[model samples]
Target: MKGWRAQPGRLAAIALLVALALFAIIKTDDVMRANALVAEEEAAMDGAAILASSLSSELDKFSLLPLALAEDPQVKALVAGDRDAARALDRRLETLASQSDAAAIYVMDAQGLTLAASNHALPTSFVNSNYAFRSYFREAMDKGSSTQFALGTVSRKPGLYIAARVGPSNAPSGVVAVKVEFDRTEENWRRATRGVYVTDREGVVLLTSEEAWRFHLTGSAPAAPRDPAEDLRQFGIAELPRLELPLAGASGEIVQVPLVEAQQAIGPAGWDIHLIVDPGPRVAAALATGRLVLVSIAVVVFAVIFALFAANRRRRAHEEAVVAQRTRTLREQLSQANRLATLGQISAGVNHEIGQPVSAIRVFAESGSKLVAAGETGQAAQNFSEIVSLADRIGAITSELRRFGRRQPGEKRIVAIGEIIDGALLLLRDRIHSHGRDIDLPEEDLRRVTVEAEHVRLEQVLVNLLQNALDATDFGGRIAIEIALLPDAVHLHVVDEGHGIPAASRDTLFHPFATSKDDGLGLGLVIAREIMRDLSGDLVFDANRQHTTFTMIIPRHR
Candidate 1:
């Protein structure tokens, strides 16, 4: 204990070791949390894909069912109200329903009176009922074909209705309709460890694995014109609070079933099929991985501490005769070292700040050299002009570094998103042309879409996005840029035919120090996000589909 007190250096080293241990623990915990989130997002996307495929198959089986049934002779006769032929038509409809696995099949007259039905065997059958108020029957008679979802008046169960007109288009006799309940799909969801549902355009759950949630409206889905309590006898659903729906841009959306999950479009009824799974398993796996990482880091930290302690002990023996003068010198040297460290950090930041412009200069110079070799003197001269401009930019950056010190980069103006895109592509032109990569640019008229943003920061963000895309893509890969002039914002999308952003890294996508590359500082995206936010904008990623998509939204200036 006396020897330990004598060595202040060892104590300082031990403190550092403790700090490092705490840092490792905190970092690991953060990483595990991120990994768990990524796992959930991936699970949601996978579930949506599976649901979409299932729905596609299900729809393919019977998208044309009502059309074919509407053409049937017996169906036409049933719609014509032939009482004697109604029994034969009912038998024929029952066979079709059984064969197609449909919930029900019915023929309704022009006045919406049911003549025959597949479920005529059941007590609450539609054999001789009227459905004049149903939207499906009314829409089919008026538009030749229609699809809708509603609770059955007779069966009192929710189902989708696909209806097609019978007889001539000029003078249709009636409608042939099929009811689909997705019972098999719901049963499958219930058995599996996942939540699944289908919602109509009005955001009402027509079918769901959770029976209680069935026929309920999500906040986004449509609602009945009249309250359910007013017509309690019409449909058997109990009124419930609407669930929140968080939309995920154009391709998909997320539902908070107490957890985030994705939903995709399915069938002609404009139903969004959502799927989600238990997050427990993946979260546990991430925790286990983090524990292993922490253990490994702890071992290394302890080993480093041990080595430093042992060396300090050995040196203490060698300097047993040394005096307080060494301590004084040591303090002075430490102060100098701190100064140098500060300078080193500043130097690294300066390099990072200037790196993009330097790279662009090089790219332009090389392109110009090639043009000169090919006798394109006029173009080569234009490239030289860009070089001079970039040199002036470097000088300005250096001046700023010398005068104002380190600061964020952004100077907002009414800048065209197209100009930003053009600048970025101009920097990457040589690479794009050399690789013969296809680049889809927005229209020239699209340049009219103005966004108030810093020209440098916007170009920097775009360049970084494009460069990352180039790194991910192979030769001959395609890259597309699309611009949307939204009512409030100008949205820019940079799409790439690459493997996509990994699900594991999705949680920290825009966060600092999140990169797959060894040399990456992982600050490009982080800086880009800051720049956009500084200019009253946002940067988001959309990797829901096969490829990668980065969306940059900026406030539009008319």
Candidate 2:
């Protein structure tokens, strides 16, 4: 179990991978945060630029109103104090104001006394009021033209007042003023759900969607520097501190509660319009982006980890498979070497077995030669026949041994078990006779017991088993080969009348080179078993029995 566990190096590699993943997670979070910050800043800058452009375009449309009004003949006549033309001029002013979306249009003498106005029908009309105190009127008298954002004296509406002189500079007569209210502009901003407002040079919020923010100074100022009005009658400077103006100044948010701001100058009024948008959603979006990046990084990290792990596993398995194949090849090589060694050991026994037959053939031939000389022709023929039979036996034995000792895989076919036994007896007959042992086997049993096996290999198996039995038996001892017919296989048992295999040699009796006799290699049983198994059979030895028996069983032929 301990050996089956993962090696420390492999465990350490996994741990290192986990550490790397943790490190990646840390770096990924940092990278995500940085990227999110960059996106947030860029979005803020873009939002500001878009808002500034929209605000500037809204104010630029009414910039030429004062120049158009000043050149009108009706306005010029009214400015010259033509009392009879007052009724027509008033009608013209009211019509012009209504048509042009102006809050009010008025004519003021050089002394700032209002002559006529679009709102003259109202109780708070500009007809009698002296607007000499108003900056737009005074600035036009001196500079001929000016843009001013102020509270209207007649309508009390906050508007941008663009005014121009009516007469020549040498004899200036009056100022014609067009007051454009930004109520629609403010409404547009409100509808768009944005915070927008315009501030004059003095930093006072003249126009805003929030009515309560009017007249409030958006920034610190030392008393409304370069005040537009000579007399601040309509606008109470004392109440400026109490007005609540929503502002984030030039930078930062410009909403009612701003985080960033975009400021642009309104061309006609010379005022700074501040545009603010909520930053809550942008901050939320940045956070969302950071989370998404982290999640994506985590997924990639885990995927890489999984792939690495799988690849490592496959590599290890391939290495193990290669190692196993190498071991199997080594085992086969060793087995083949052992077989060749066994063949060398048995060759001497084969020479002795063949010598006996040759000696017998010579003896029978000499007998036949003597009988032929004595003129017993029939008897001589029988003697010669016996010599030929012995010679054939010798040739058969030598041929089978020569073919079996060669390094070749023998072909398998259906063969009778008796044929294998007869071949083995042929080779071992001299040894059997030399040992003075009788091998018992009935001719009827030999042909009926059949097996499927290679002819030479089967003969080799029987020879090895019978040789062992012949060697173990005492002089004049009996050796028996008994065939046991089974349902699936044919079993041949070679039993020897000898002292049983020693207890100490029993375990490794069939082991190669482990032998009881000094000259024995102990590979006989090993080779026999190997041969039997190659024929889809097995070798079993029963040393515990009264008589030692070595059985070679091969599968029955169909």
Candidate 3:
């Protein structure tokens, strides 16, 4: 009789626990589903806002075209009744339309007769076509400028027409208009979302990623009945059918459908863009995650209670061993990463150092072959000697790069400034001669100045600066090397008269992998700067000048 009474108490406790567990699960599901829907809706809103911004940007980009074209001399002349200007204006508009990615560009008289168009050569050209009844034409003439989105009368394609009046505002001569299409924008939206559409103030869809939704009403019906003629002119249809999209409801409530919708205004044009997304996948994932977390907590609590009575010493020792092994593996990975990074730096240095000599050797070999064919034996022999010298220089560069990679100090010696400049110029002789660029060396007395540096490294730095100057200077331009003697250092400036370095590039001028040249490896300046620092000197850019200047400051050898 006592055991039966205890069973009833145990059963009551079990029922209480079961009720709490069920309540927790239900609450978790509700919270997860609500959060998932909110996230999906927010994401949809972001997408809609981006698409709206893009549409606004596209419209704004082409809006100024008509206004600028209205000021063109040819357009003005054509508007002044000069028939000869029509052919020229046609070609001009064609070129402008192609360059600006516009669907069409045309000029119309005050009476709305198309005088000239970009597609004049096409069979379906707008020339001689009348668009007097178009709202854009009438509004532009009266208000000085106007924009309207409508279906093309001839092509039947939809586009936004931007029009601007030509001549005085009081009495305009004609109007210039540019049409911009949104096929690309709609294609992009289709690739990004399930559904997207843009609606006018009247709730009629003007642009949509879904083809079936275009020219349809977003609401159950139009706010008011539209004139059949006006509807036909704007949308090529007398009436529009409502899309099956549902209106957004209050948030956090579970709905029958799994779709979330968001809308954003495109611009002041009273256009609204709607983006739809399916939240079923996110909601399912959240539910699965919540259940897994709840089940894991239950399992972990049971495990912890059981682990308190188990053998802990062995387990703790095993965990320590595992941790030690993991530490060793991570150390090995870090060491390997360090080795790879060092190897990459060395490779870049070798490539930059060897590039100039290899190019010189090729130029010399080509000249030598030509000289041999022309029976110029002495000149050919000289070219062969130069190629051999360049080959030896390449070998030296590889050894220097290895030392640089190892962080070993290069051998320093007293090198005259003149010799360094001469060496660099000799290496770039072919480039200078080919491009017809002038190099103005310092005075002969100043050339005798000496600096404490590694000869080859110093020569390499000069070569890099001179090469950059050569690339920047135009044909027949001048590059000057000026020497400024300081109390303890010598400042050698490589100045070029070509287009100066862009302001945007000055900050990252010496950063690795930052270059203005299309073919540049972006390592030359980095290596050059490092070499200067290694030699106990520094390289710096001088921006307070009319031309681009790079100054190399070195310790003067007494």
Candidate 4:
């Protein structure tokens, strides 16, 4: 009954019903809009197909005219025996090239010998070359007034060849071939918004509305034309017939006509036409209107729901915010408590550490006062020496405390690793002497290696590892310290003969708060590792033989 107040529950149920109804309506509208767009695109593609068929038919008619002209008596005489055949052929070619979109013309004498070529200036001499192996040759001699698409070897041009034989055919007569440049026809077709090309069985652009390049297999080559297909290939147009996979330059509709499979006219060759389409006006308008309608309905539904549950929604939101605030406050308070507990432990250590230095100073002052009261010169000198020693000890303890408490400096300098070990040992000297632990030093000649580092940080790292080794070893147990100089690095080792670090804990010993000590802050090794890394050195633990060796490696150059 806590959340069952009639106003909030009833309003929530009513809002849910309204939301579901609106969602259904919106989804239905979206589906309808998508289907309509698809239908419009299909209609546009059908129109492109009709245009392609009409254009192909027109090209078919034009292709036949070239063959008909080749059969003329005057053309035959010029091709067969005229000594001025080159000039006549030139005139005929120019006429044909101008009359139609043909690129060039050539004639063959009786017995299938090349007579003359239209483009005399062109470096191709087609004279006396049999046209027997060519597609146009086969069509003219056997098929009669036929056109074929093929790549010409001499000129390296791909075009349509319309060929015809004249006078005494079936025996061996003259032949004329008209070369229609498919590239020009392709260029004209490309001007439309949606356009494509068609080719015969030989991959020649027959009825094309798109730009294409020429590739010939024969004839003295002319200057190569600029390639338009370069950019088109990058835009995925080279995958033609497969062009319908997606629109190239823009989004919307695209269609492809696989002339070979779809129309069955030139099936062997990969002939196809592609159509790029723009959306129709009606479909565009429909999409805009549908979006507006959907938005309006969403607004109305939201308004009605808000009106029904205005007060209750406000109350619930406010309650949730208050609860969240309380939860965050509790978490913060718990975190603060944990921090204070940590501070308490560190404070106790600080007090114990400082007490020793303060007591020693007090004892030294008392002894100085006793010597002053006695007024004995030699005894006074001895008391003064004692005071000086205590003072030095106090100073040393204070420095170590300050160093441990303070932040590290950013400046770096060349520091000898042995110097760091000496500083740490000085601070531990009193404790080491009191415990009667044996300390060893490297031989004078072996301790010459130096490395680039922060001196204070290197000392701190050494002290941390040394203290851990001391705490682990029993009284009178051996703890060996060694410094080995290698070619690249100087290795500092602290090995303890007491119970070695457990195999499981060895890997994570350098991690924060990882310790075996009962009252351990668990931060010493962690801090050591961090400082070593800052100086481009590393601290690692190794349990090679029986001893647990903590090795600090500092690179000589770094």
Candidate 1: segments with Cα more than 4 A from true spot: 7-15, 222-240, 244-258, 277-280, 297-558
For candidate 3, lDDT tens digit of each residue in 347-438? Answer: 54456557878999999999999999999999999999999998998876555445333432357888799988876665565567767988
Better of 2 and 4 by lDDT: 2
Stronger candidate by lDDT (1 vs 2) = 1
Steric overlap count per candidate = 4, 6, 0, 17
lDDT of 1: 0.75
The model with the greatest lDDT is: 3
lDDT of 4 by residue, 165-203 (tens): 766555646678777665544565566544454543333
Q: Write the per-residue lDDT of candidate 1 for residues 254-335, one digit (tens) a residue.
A: 4322356687888555778887555556766787888887788668868977898889998997786465568646543533
- Which ten-residue region of model 4 has the weakest summed lDDT? 213-222
Ranking by TM-score: 3, 1, 2, 4
TM-scores, all models, native as reference? 0.48, 0.45, 0.52, 0.39
- Tell me, what's the RMSD of every candidate? 24.1, 32.3, 22.0, 17.3
Q: Model 2, 1-558: lDDT tens per residue?
A: 565576877888999988986776667656765565566556655655665576666556555777787888877877787878877788888998898787888888778888888888978788878878777777788888877776665666667777888898888899888777777777876676456666776677777766666787676334534443432654655456533434453233444323454566655455676655555566556556666776787788689779988899999999999999997576545545555654665667678877777888888889889999999999999988888888887788778667656555457877777787777776666667666788888568556666778877777767767767766777888888888778998778888887668888888876888888787667667766766786789998876667888887788888
From the highest lDDT down, the ranking of the candidates is 3, 1, 2, 4
Task: Judging by lDDT, tell me the better candidate of 1 and 4.
Answer: 1
Q: What TM-score does prediction 4 earn?
A: 0.39
- Alpha-carbon lDDT, every model: 0.75, 0.72, 0.82, 0.62
